[model samples]
Target: MSRTIPFHFVDVFAVAPLTGNSLAVVDGGGELALELMQNIAREFNQSETTFVLPATRPDADWKLRSFTPKGVEVFGAGGHNTLGAWWWLAAAGRLELGDGPTRFHQQIGDLVYPLAIWQSQGKLEKIIMRQEAPVAGRQLSNLGALATALGLNAEEIAADVVPCQVVSTGAAHLLVPIRDRQAVDRISPDAKQLFDLLNEVGGEGCYVFSLDPLQPGTTAYARFFNPTVGISEDPATGTAAGPLAAHLVAHGLAQPGVIKVEQGTTLGRTSIIEVGVDAGSVSVSGRGIVVASGAFSI
Candidate 1:
């Protein structure tokens, strides 16, 4: 028998209540089937919907399963899916917090990560996610071809600042650099072309960046386009931001330290993503706000 399933909506990596990327979180997934969760995700149609379940392994505190509206399973080594749920639980007083920062573990697939929750006065202030160690993948040799695919002039592709390369902290993304903010603002990509190009290069999507940021404190301005998994543009992408930080450090564009990034302004929903790099590991953290919640019965 179909039952009413309760889900929460959160603005992940948000600066304000309504901004940042949106997500739907379903708790108590141990009794729910994978197919049911996928159908729920399709019904929600958010960027992602995450299901929280009791941890099957002794090492992990909880289990998370994330899906796109298209029912595509998103890799969850580190991203907003896990963060949003954890944030909701901690903020709602569902998770136990002993009056200070608490450490826990979460598992997605074969990877288990250390999760830190900071709660002040029974409200979640922020979540610090330690992503997988950075993996510097292939640098695109065919910048001209990539430019054509992204609808950018070959000259506008900031080859001098840093070459567009494939990088992954967990999920793979092609990081492209534009010379200036004006160049970044003018991008109009053929979705099909960009999607096909990324698929061929082993990336889930591409993150176009500009060193010329809108604000002085932010290190870069960026936009994410992913058609392979049905996302045309993401407001904020923690998955891509981690890799972008590592890519910048590898190319000497930014020092090996905490770098702030601005995204989603062009789309009206502005978001700030923080990236921390030391040695080879990258940490991404941000704030999430609970926007809405409801129950859906099928």
Candidate 2:
């Protein structure tokens, strides 16, 4: 017998239907095999595809597992994949959201984190998730090799602004500060070289950014690339954005508050991510648009 699975497409951090990072959410996926889930993720071919499963623990309301197009199971709760999953949950009438902020727990990997959904007169306004505290990891020592891998001159990498380092809010990723947004946009990473560097540093992805943002009031303009997981580029990445915000605050480049990072302009997606950092805690908040829904028979 064949199984018919329902799924929805959400544009995370989007103001419009086609903008932001696209995510495919598979509903009622508790019983789906892991290999089948990976296959479904590949079929969707989005930056990330999420599967909604029943909560395995009492402290959690639901369980979410996300997989990349390359079949890598993403465990971090700080990314757009998990955010979009909960957005669909509330929008689909699965969760009872009272007016104002409602707290819910989500289980991703071995941990359960609290997430908040803000509602005004029963309308879901935004979803905010508190990520793990920031951890400033290894600093990339080879700017020359990194510059060549990114197809830029060594001088383009602005080590003076902030040293190229690996930081984690939920997942570890390399943060490369460029001189300006122009050089940030000019990045053309050699997949093999970039992958090797990331592997050596134990980073999952690379986030190249600059202080000059296209939008006013935004702190940074950035792009995401993860050859390790086969994501060539991501329009919006909450996991990376959260870490970047915390990193800036650690460097005194940004104060503790809601810092907005503008991303996806180079890819024409254009996403604005609001990251809040206060007293060592980091959170990412955004609204997602449910663009489409359908059933997959397999």
Candidate 3:
């Protein structure tokens, strides 16, 4: 007999549903094989999906596995997945508001998600998560060859943002800072070339940002593309945001504190991601809403 498993679809980093990046959560996925998890994620066709399993250790909180629609397992973490999993657990009554720091054992290592709920207008709000410290990688050369790989004019890139580098909080990405927002909005990457270059250099994807550091409230306008991983465009990318914030601070582009990043404008799904970096450690946080929940038998 086949048993049905309940799942949730959550929009992460958006105040309203369908505005932020969506993730599908399978609450008890320990019994499923890696191939099965990848198949389910591809069937859902989201940018990313998560599988949650019970923790083996008594002091552990939860074990999670993340997958892209193309069946590739992701290491480290994604901002939306962390929030989506917690929201599903809390809403299902498996986790309580006072559960302290919920631990997540991922392929990367141990990740702690501290839950916090607040009452506003007599309604309960879900907890927001702060990501762990980011790990920085080697700074690659920002030569003309790299620009060609991205289908961008070498002259269009900002001269001041030297050493077009690869950075990672948990996931590695190419940090490409453009001269202006026009380049960011207009340029389209040669997905195949970009992916090949990233893999050759041991990076996951590329993040392009137009610097507008002088803006009062906004820090930068950015876009992320990962065709190699089957994400044409991300509505809101929390994993990239953390390193972007660090890049901004390291390059003297913005003040070292909290800054707001706007993404998905060209895609018609506007989303805001907030990040904080201090002393080389980065933390990304955002609000998410549960759009739909249901069960499926496999």
TM-score top scorer:
2
**lDDT, candidate 2, 183-294, per-residue tens:** 9999999999999999989899999999989999999999999999999999999999999999999999999999999989899899999999999999999999999999
Misplaced by over 4 Å in model 2 are none
lDDT of each: 0.86, 0.94, 0.73
Output the worst ten-in-a-row residue range by lDDT, candidate 3. 99-108
The candidate scoring highest on lDDT is: 2
Q: Could you tell me the lDDT of residue 188 within candidate 3? A: 74
- Arranged by TM-score, best first: 2, 1, 3
Candidate 3 lDDT over 1-298, as tens digits, reads: 8878878898777746677778899877888888889999998988889888876555557777788999987655547776667667666667544434433333333554443444344334544445556656766565576678666788877756645677888777877888888778887777787777777667777788886633357788888888768888787787888888887788788888887888877776667787888887676666667789899998
- Cα displacement (angstroms), candidate 2, residue 257, comes to 0.5
Candidate 2: C-alpha RMSD after superposition: 0.7
Clashes of 3: 0
Residue 101, candidate 1: Cα error in Å is 2.5
* Candidate 1 residue spans exceeding 4 A from truth: none
User: What is the TM-score of each predicted model, taking all chains together?
Assistant: 0.96, 0.99, 0.87
